[model samples]
Target: MRHRPATYLEAEEVRAILARPNPATVEGGRDYALLLFLYNTGARVSEAADLCWSDLQLTAPRLVCLHGKGRKDRLLPLWRDTVAALHRLRMNAQPDRQPHVFLNRRGEALSRDGIAYILRRHVQGATQALPTLDRKRITPHVLRHSCAVALLQSGTDITVIRDYLGHASIATTGRYLSTNLQTKRDALETFWQHAGIRPVRAKAWKPTPNLLAFLDSL
Candidate 1:
């Protein structure tokens, strides 16, 4: 069956969701960091859930090694904000032997379901500030789609996004090209420029004499 175009959040909507988590508390900090990480790296929910401290390089040239499908691993650069949020989460975390980057109230590694629940809760809370979010079904994978679209909008190469998302084929990444309205508008503008097609304004319409006579008969 054909799948629908992926649902994604605009950058501002993403910012609103990220703001929902109160970073002052441990769980709140983790939730924020988790959401930021998903947006930053376009990681699959499973990859994010399975992340470990050993998978990260939090220092200069911050990077993460995401273990993807079929044991394929890809390295992604971390955004400065992502690094900062993660740092705060680490500092606030209760001392524990858990190696996972994200943990629950019981200090166990967060499962994929746990991550989804966190995203859903935050999305609901964010809806008050961004009513548009209420119309979209936001999920962890939607964040992945949003990341890909954001990269495309910023002029990042499609192949780079393919590898960034750890897609086995470039074809999977190409789907993002069709989902962005701004990208389509840009393409159309470029096409018009190259084709020498000048936009013409439509003349205002008035009823024809025959049509006016017919209406008058009624």
Candidate 2:
């Protein structure tokens, strides 16, 4: 049996989800930053949960080293907004620092469930505003799929997305290629453009011989 196609948030849904925080909440910044980081990095929930401060390199060329399945490591570049979010979530002035980049309210490392809860809360809040979000279950895999789909839609080469997602095989990354509507639209548009152009050809001409006379002579 064929499996369902992967689902991803549209660019607008991403914007609405990130617009969740209000000033009254102390943890608002932290929560917003965490979700943005998750979406931007396309890191797995476990990968994000296991992320330590030591794994980040937020310099001129901001990037993160995500430890994905099979203990394999892959590096991905970060957007400026994501880098800024991590910057805003700077560690507390406490003497002993929490090893993880993201932490619970109690200053402990964030678990996968903790991160998922945060994502769910934000997605739920956005649901009232965007009813479309209600129809789907937004999980970490969905966020990961969103990342790949976003890159594909933006015209990033497939091989690059494969490396970015750290897939064991290029075929796994190729799932995005098979189902992207934008890709099909682009292909169809190109076909239409080519079809509109007619090739140079010889002009139509009347027959040189007289058909009735030729037949009678034969």
Number of the predicted model whose TM-score against the real structure is largest? 1
Error of 1 at 98 (Å): 0.6
Candidate lDDT scores, in order, read 0.71, 0.63
The local lDDT score (0 to 100) that residue 67 gets in candidate 1 is 90
**Per-residue alpha-carbon lDDT of model 2 for 1-218, expressed as tens digits?**
33344566666676677788652354787787777777676688888888887787878656777888777776666666677777777644132567787788898888888988888898999988999999888976677766655555555555555556666432335466344323433432332222211222223322223322221221
User: Which is the leading candidate under lDDT?
Assistant: 1
Model 1, span 1-218: residue lDDT tens: 33334566666778789889998888899999999899777899999999988888889757787898877776666766778988897785544477889988888889999999999999999999989999998889888876766655555555555666776432325455334323433432332232211333323334344433322221
Q: What's model 1's TM-score?
A: 0.74
User: What's the alpha carbon RMSD for model 2?
Assistant: 18.3
Error of 1 at 182 (Å): 26
Clashes of each: 0, 0
